[model samples]
Target: MAKRGAAQQLQTEVKTDEELEKFLARPGLLILEVYSEWCGPCLGVLGTLRRIKLEIGGENLHLAICRADTITALKRFYKRSEPTWLFATGGKAVSIFYGSDAPKLVAVIIRELEKTLQNASRPTYQIGDLQPIEAEVLRIKTEAIKKAERIEHEKQEKKRIDYLNRCTDVIMENLPDIGVTVFGPQVSRDMFKKLSEPAEHLKMQCKDRKYLEVFAKDFEIINYSCKNPLSDDVIDQLDGKELLVCFWKIDEASGPITHVLSTYAHELTKERVAPPDDEINVPHPIAPIISPIKVKFEVEIEDGEVWVEEISSEEEARKLAERKAAEKSKSATHLQDESRPKDQEGAEDDDEEEASEEEEAMQAVQPAFPNMALDIDLGLDDNIVSEEEMVEEEEEPPKPLTRIKRVKIPPIWVANNRRTHAALIYVFFRSQTSGFLPPDPPPEPPHVVMAFEAFKRDDVMEVVEASKEDVPQYGFFTNDTPGEAKLITNSIYKYDKLEEPSSSDRIVLKVNKVQSYTMLSLVQFEPTYCSNNVTSGRMDALKFFPEDYKTDEEIPPDAQKKQKKKKKTQDASGVDESPKLSTETAKSIDIAAGDENTEDSPKALEGEAQTPEVQAGETLITESPTVADPSAVPTEGAPAAGDGTDTQEPPKEEINADLIEAPAVDGAAAATPAAPTDPAPME
Candidate 1:
């Protein structure tokens, strides 16, 4: 069912350097397909190449295959992956066609070949070595390029934040607070498994207090639950009242790697009240908890003489009675007020005006406000929207009022001396595939992620114990696999670098081992060819002009010869106009007779000063080239054969408004090119 050697002819494979070199050395043009077979999309590439070969399998075109396994080979010639083709001719690559479109591929190759043939018929200058002058020019160009790149990078960063801000309503939105716990999907779970392989024993050794202490000092784990579950309901039920409000968080792994990754991914949520509002008299979302839960707001239960704690105090009950009475009065008043037509109309008008003003404010600020989430709570209660209900959602079961004050404490990592001057961590595993467990019981900090606030390993154990009230228990997890460690480490390192300075800022530094060789490849040394044997050189006259010498405006052939004669006569007059043009440019212009006449013009200038010494303070413009006398040119070429030439012409050089305004050039080279071989001069 298959053609013989069809598979051999259509070898969909990666080629070694040997194969690539042999193909490149062949006659005509050889298009080598560079690709990896493991890539799923590469099959389309094979089909495209096959179609191209079928269409252009002629004498002028040839086809080959290449693979990018060898780093050296890839660096030298090919780019990574499938769907890339290098068009080679005469041992040098001429063009590249990318993608898996058959028609497009054929058309590109055909166009290139046609252009190559046409170019072969034209005259071309031999490329000379890139001397000092060219290198200097390149240096300036490179600096300009680098400056542009920096500017662009800054712009992109600003734009990225700007876009994000537009979508979110939070102010200081881009400024992520230092040390905030983050939550996000895992990016490199496999890498973590590999790196944690050798440390698998530590998972068991965690039983030892010393070992546990070490890990606990480095990290802490807590089970974080958004909803109070049966296991965690006890935290709120410990005293006398039913469970009010509780939350839980747990870390999936131990060590700096886990902490950095979780933080970078925003995997940890902030310890917060049910809802955050400025009007809330309770703790702010980012504020710290000063003490454990207080169970009583009405009366206190006493242990012997000392009051152990109050479940509810008499004073609090009285206050609640007063609040209920006020509510009852307010309700009665509202009922009576609703029956009044004037009151009803006034309330309606106020509501409409408030709604209109809010809409206007939102529209005005919409562009600058990113991440704006509109919350439409239809069942929101109206108790005049007091500080408690307005700022923080009411705690379920009607929590007894408790005082919450903010306090500042050093980060646990720093207090426990787990973090030194600086450290770098990378994550290889994410808690996606493998769910994380609650921290185990311990005396010190529990070894976990997102618990940087715990000072000792035992503290982690305390948090773990606290979590056992409701947290799902963690068991032994095995994630070791090839390349897992590297991936995890890199992920953590990236996380640390991306963290805010205030939270985990001490760890950032210059990053290396980045694999952007496309830019680096260009900076590498390569031999250059140019015409100049001198260490430094400048552009030649012909380079500025093409051979098709047609100008938009041209002088007549007779007029051209007359111009030449006038130049010769100027030389014979012993005036050194030759100084105006550079020596190299003069040679390219083929002004040999002018220089020779200069040598023969001593008799003509016998009485003239060589310098034409302008009398004290008189400008040279007052002399010959400017404000010319009526006798400057022979009237209408009265002498038909001026200076032995049939055609006598007026001066070709004329000043224009712009040229006259240009600053006079100092008698020196305008610019110089740098030489690679020469050391740059010290300023």
Candidate 2:
């Protein structure tokens, strides 16, 4: 038994005749695959097999895979890259199929199963013999097939060259500028002539992949450049200009040219070849990104989190990588120095060794899962073997409506993810005109959610049906600092007129065009009260928590008591306070549990804050100015609405002062609970 790599279908690994017999004996109609050890089974077929099992129901079928070279019956397919399917029932292979033809395989299996189902008594069974062919004969057939495929490929190549040759001379106005805007420096007329200069191997991706697979091992088209690889005349033309062009051979566009990709910007520099071992490496920085839970992204909470904006170019990423690597080197040196102070005599040698170690650590070599180039995409589209590959997904049951909860976002979520804010907004709306309560906050924020991936990284301002909607926009924003990765939005569309604040700022929609938002240098204001009348049918408006807002467990015992007592007393009075308003204000502002000395806490404004909305029918509720301790001050000259009733008020705990002057969050009010006195609750 030759040693096979682990990726080979080893679950039903057939080593001996006994194992093979048992596998075939599996109760239902079984499809056993034969694969070589060196050349693994086609992985793309795994999805198809899974669909077959799921669609037809697994109880009716059994699927397995085993090494081909080990089984004498499969010796003909031992080294073949194409697949072989062995259909078995009643402890033996009944029929066989060669090639990874998904449609043919599916049709055959389905027809067999249908025949079995229709003729239960008088069954139609076709016994196809599994014979092993002579190695020489197999080689001859393979050679003939290869020669035919080569001629066909050459013909296609000629066609492609003819097309390019026509375009090279004649200035055809339309030269198929497809994917230029998205994946380009754009391939222009003059540039297309220069594009024909990417050495012959580079033009053909297969040839390029074959070369890279042997040398690079990573199966990626790494762009490298020399100061002047082109002739002087060519160099003179493109010297200072960015090469706004890329080329895709027009020949390979059936369906599988699917992964046709983009290029990395490689600056042509002076040719400087060094010894392979001493290539003078630059190591990438290996700093752990801060992404903590609950309160805020630990990156923001921790001192280690580095704020990295857009790494716009390869130059920028490389520079950042170098700086990160250096930081690690220094940190490692510091640790080593502490551990072995007595070895200070060889400190210089130790430093050299450490530098070498860093270089080795950053070496672009991954030895594990060797020969994975066979599976790597490498910008080649695979041939679609099956026609009409429709995936019918069973309709899942409608999930119960969930109330939106606070999402504790990590700092790393902002990196490479442009839709960080926009996506979180959709969590609230059931549809454009409808609103639904998001699910309650779990102990830990869910780090993943389902999404339909329609846009790529470069598709920033794509216009969609939803984008044209006149409905108000929604998204996340940070209150702690401006321009931080927003956690969620406080977007509320109130159909009520608002009172003009003396010093409130306004963003006049001078135009309805979309503009990128800038943050932190903001004058945001939040209302102290959240009205329950915003939703239609007077449904309580959905509310969620912010960064400063503490969970039930985080809330201090005394503060919780104050909240409960306050709610009880409010019920006693005729004040119609919304449950959300009462509880939301208390949970949001009761950060008395936090370290008072912590400097990061946001400072609220002095004096009482006001809600701009002054609807006649809408009852007004405010987080009235709270005293340090309610018992310290005595109430006087207050109207007794509770008929001579002496009621106990909420114990006034001094709320975090940082929350006083709430930032102007559009929909949500700055809900800091007022210190309740032993009197009728203020309305």
Candidate 3:
């Protein structure tokens, strides 16, 4: 039973010699104990081996026991006594233990195991340990990688160049004259090719011959080129594909070329065509042939119905109607001719006769005022007074004044009446309900207004006379109705010269009958106030009178005296003498008084009327103020409190030609008179 049990235990734990070699070939430490069951030391070492196996566990070291008595291969391979031990690692023999000294043997095994482990852990080779073949292989791989990258870059560059070339060709073909040069980085050929389809489509779409003709005539393309080409990704978009091209138009006169950017294929789509419908065919029989006859027939179609033509056979009716119309037209023309006035020559003769009668009438009725004539014809058609009324007025001439009427008259009225006898009249009407006059007259006078009562009433004359006194600025008159008074007033007023009148101003109204028209004459008066008698005489003398009243012998005494004096002066000088400023002397004075206020400096006097002296070798004579006017007042008044009239004239200073610079007259410089020095005080 013990032998069987030991045999079973040995069979499980102990490995054969071949197995021991296989176990040593593995990666970790392998420990083996060669033993015999009959040996007491071997039996005793079993327990120690078990303890060593536990110390060196399965992970780091493998433990196997070989019974030399039971295993022939291990028995021959070990060739050691019972209880001997062997240690191997990584297929190498580490050490062999011969005696049964458990502690010493275990120590030796552990030391050898550690030595194998240390050797196995160290790298087999140091840095720079590559073989020749490996170095060559690494270099080849590096060169291959760089070459692949370069090829890829070249492929991309080729594609870009191709795209640019194709785009340039297309632009040049379309715009042969546009002198455009394509430039910039290359782009994708696919995008450039895609642009052409739409560009051609646009060219086809512009079908108007006139537009094409105008484009060709107005602008000649000198060059066309790509600017910045589109990218491949952008061109690949489903819609809105655009390519920009720069085109330059050449000027016919060799002027500057116009450069413009044009886009193509930006938005385009294929034209859609509608599908055709199915067709149908049907056969029809032909009519049989027939012989024709030479008979004539006429057919007429009217209002969607056919009929034959027929003549009225009454030709005289239209001619008779036309003849009657002609006769009626002739009668109408004869009536129009009879309705017209007399011929131009006879009418002109009649007008001349009437003008001669009017002239005779005007001459007969001329007024008594000198150079003052009134030609009042009043036209036979005066609506205000009929011919019968005029005849009655002529028969009853204004009765001679029975008594003198005293009226306050303005001085201005007398003054104006003495000159032109013309005046402005203003008429005012009262409101029917209120019986009140319109508010204060307009700023300007000679205005007409409606009256409460008609002018024909006797009360109207009293009202007008009262108004004349109440509103003294405006003249009031009444004759017939207010409407007739307005017409006469407007004709006489003509214009209003005065706006507001002073307290002393007055207006007078005179009513008279001229032929058939009722005439109203107005006389406005504004007083003239003068401070002195001289002003009054001058004002009166300057009054304007008609030319017929003026005569050559009527010249004023003062004017005749002025003309004689002027003639005497001209005779003495042989020419009219007038004082003029000497520009050269004034310029010299301005230059001499440096930095001084011009007003403070003594003024240069004007040259006297005497002829200027001419210097030798000079054409222009520089005139100087040689003689001061005795009547002229001195600008620098008498010193302190003395009157300016008492001041004596400053003595003239002789000019030095060398001190001043004046323009050369003929060949020599013109002499400028020196400015006067400060004047000496009078005694």
Candidate 4:
């Protein structure tokens, strides 16, 4: 059966009756055969059917062959011989052919197709068609598509919600705890609420901590342990389980909460360790020994006063020196020896050898002396001098004992703008030989004394008046020699007046010899105390009255009255002696002065004299009126005034004696005022 099925697949063959039915039910015409492969007639008809199918063309017809063994139902239904042919269209049998009659079958199929075409071309009864099944199928397909789309959207939404929930869980797990008791309940609640908002927003957007941190710019996460102790209730609720805890607080106003503290309870998990089962071998240790090594170094010795080459024996050094001397002598007289005879040269060599030997023997016997001249030989009697005699000649007589005056001037301290209340003086003395000898018991010890005095002024004259009671003497050792000694003492003064000193106040330090009272040195320094008070209110009164004086308390009443009277008299004398003109009188004077009329000049003078009533309180001068020199008067065009002295004056005009009024003196006396004898005429 499998072979027959395989053979049938090579050709277009139906495997079952149902497949044959489906083939016949197709829209186009189909021709099918039910055959048994073992039958000779079936084998012979297969080629004829294929030829007929080729003639008909596949587009308009479908040809199929079915094996009897594979499609038993179709063969039984047909009730045909070994090779039976059936023609069908639109699921109905049109013709059937038995046996291998290829020509008759083809002719019959052509005739049937022509009849069908004729029937199709004719105007057959037309019925309006409805495609309800197609419409139903389309509707079902669209519903299925919408269902799939809705499922996808739901899956995406579920995924988003699950992600959002996971993000929220992570944020909550990492959320820090605000200190409830430390920050107070209200503040802690507010901080917690602030922390929750960002977390909630991020959770809604399915964002993780990384994305949440992008928007949370105002806060930071600090890894620190909480300082607050957990309550018993919390511990009980936790059931001793290890859990991570975090603390948070708002870092700034209107900002997210920051994790300020965090802590975690560590799980106590014991890890077991198994001991090694393998045996180990231990090696013996060896100790190391360090041996010290002594290194010897050779140093070249150069001849010097302090550093000299060490000689094993003095005789060897002497011999070396003798050899060097002999070599030098031979080199020095080499030319002389060359010019001399050979016997003379040998004699000179023997003489030099004998002299070198003698010098070496003397050096070996002589004691070494520091700085001794090497050129002087002890062997030469003429050059030798006794050590005692040399010492006596070279030694210098002891220097004449001379006394040196030693004085020290210590730093002087002066108060600024204030009198010196107290001062410390230190005097150190040391003689020139004191540094070489012990500073004790001397033949003549000079007495040293220092005097401290405060002066009101910087001049030496003021030093005499300086309070002598405060000038203390600082004395050094009176009996012992004044070798090296120090005298330290303090001097204090009490001024009769407790007034602060000015910047110009000075202090004088004097060091004097006790016997002669000769002043060795005198230093004067201005006090610098309270310099800032110069411009203050304390000195403001001094600006006007620079001198200080005592105030008087008692005075006679008559003396007071006399002083007042004298002041009034002085004030009255200060007023101007010239009479003061009233406004109207001044205007009258100005008008009279401006008058061009020459005859009015006398009238104007007479008018001014007549105005005696205007000078009520004014004191007017009264003197003898001067008589005019008739010849000294200047005439018109005669030299103008101030040009040259006039030899002859203009003829004097006779004054009207009645018009000229006597000058008034404060309404008391009207007398003629003193005028010059030579009356300078007005130009």
* Residues 1-683, model 2: lDDT tens digits: 24355323323557555677677666767777878764567676778876777678356677777777687655656545557777766655556677777888888889766654454443223223433433355577668656755665677567655543443222212322111111111223343333333323233231111000111211111111112122332223333433232223322442212122221111111133444354446533332212223221112223454444433378688999999999999999999878885667588788999999988886746565576665566754676444434332334554544332222322211101112111212221113212233332333211111111111101211221123232122222221111122333222111011243111111110111224221111112222112222221011111122224322213445557677567545544534354333433544443533332133222333343442322112222332244565344323322234334332222222222222333434554444323233345554
Top model by lDDT, which number?
Answer: 2
Cα lDDT of model 3 by residue, 319-428, tens digit: 77889999999999999878877787588889999999999999888665768667888786646787898899889965443322222211011101100100000000
| Per-residue error (Å), model 1, residue 317 | 92
What's the TM-score of every candidate structure? 0.21, 0.19, 0.15, 0.16
lDDT for position 509 in model 2: 8
lDDT of 4 by residue, 1-683 (tens): 99677444434668776776677666555666666433313556567655655566445666777766666545442322335666666666655555576678778677766655555532221111113443465488668656755665677567655543443333333332122111111122223333344434322221111111111111111101122333333223333232222222323332322221111000011222334445534433332111112222244333442443334467688989999999999997996757878888789899999999999999987876857867865677877789998999889686543322222211111111100010000001112223332443332222222222233323422443353322222221111111112222111222213265322222322222234323322333322221123222122112211233222223456556676456435435553334555545544644643432222221113223423221212223222233365445443222323434433211112111212334444555332322222445663
TM-score, cand. 2 vs. native: 0.19
Model 2 alpha-carbon drift over 4 Å, by segment: 1-11, 118-128, 131-683
Residue 360, model 1, lDDT: 99
Better of 2 and 3 by TM-score: 2
RMSD of each: 34.7, 35.4, 66.1, 65.1
Candidate numbers sorted by TM-score from highest down: 1, 2, 4, 3
| Global lDDT scores for all candidate models | 0.36, 0.38, 0.37, 0.37
The better-scoring model by TM-score among 1 and 2 is 1
